[model samples]
Target: MGRAIALGLPLLVVAEIAVFVLVGSWIGYPWAVLAVLAASFAGLMLLRREGMRAWRGFIAAANSGQHPGERVIDGIVGLGAGVLLTVPGFVTALTGLVLLFPPTRSVARRGVQRWTERRVSSAVAGDLFGPRKVRVRRGAPDVDGAIEGEIVEPR
Candidate 1:
């Protein structure tokens, strides 16, 4: 991840700059700048609207005794989209727009979830000292297993 970011960020910046120049040339530089600003404003408005919806959904889910995990994820993704839109790049703005839209957001959500889960598992597995596998058979102790009382010796 670190390596990818180190390399990808510079590449992204360069690409964005190139795109900006190309667009500015095609249109007028002033119009191009205004377009970018307009996109940013639109994105910010969308982010605020979606963010409020996400928060309300979270609260409703919690009140109903349901897990608000999906709502949290939505909020996070929305926030990311908002940030991307504010980055002053057409590429980033496009990506952010996709994330803000429901159809594309669903697809992106799955990818993000998988990536996050993989990263979390790798970190956790690396940190643990115990065996990774657990052997279980039908009729093997209770779910919590048996807890035997042991004497503690003080030094």
Candidate 2:
């Protein structure tokens, strides 16, 4: 992940710059600048609205004695979308808008959930998102199942 980010960041910047230049050439420099500014402003508004909605949902969940995990995840998604929108790039803004809309947001939410489940332990994921059904496979009984490990004492 770290390596991907290290490479992806630069690539994203290059893509953003290229897109900006292309758009500018097609629609004139001033219009391109205005478009960027407009996107940023729209992002700010979305951030504020989503932030409040997330906060309210979190509070409501807590008050109702329900797990706030889903709300927390929603809040994270909203925050990310807002930040992406605020970034000065068409690519980021488009990605943010995708997250903002309901259908796309749900898709993004599921993706995040799946990613989280993969990265986190089952126990932790269960605590956050509730229990998940897991499939267990039986190995051959004749095969040795003992594991080997070496524990080094700290000097």
Best model per lDDT: 2
lDDT of candidate 1 over 31-108, digit per residue (tens): 999989988898788778778988898888778776565666677788888878977889999899788789888777
Top TM-score hit: 2
List where candidate 2 sits over 4 angstroms from the true fold.
138-155
Candidate 2: worst-modelled 10 consecutive residues by lDDT: 146-155
Residue 125 in candidate 2 has what lDDT?
A: 76
Model 1 regions lying over 4 Å from their true place? 119-155
Q: RMSD in angstroms, all models?
A: 10.6, 7.9
Write the residue-wise lDDT of candidate 2 on 1-155 in tens digits: 89999999999999999999999999999999999999999889878988898899889987987767678788879988998999998999999988878898777777787787778986887776766664445555445774434322112
Model 2 clash pairs are none
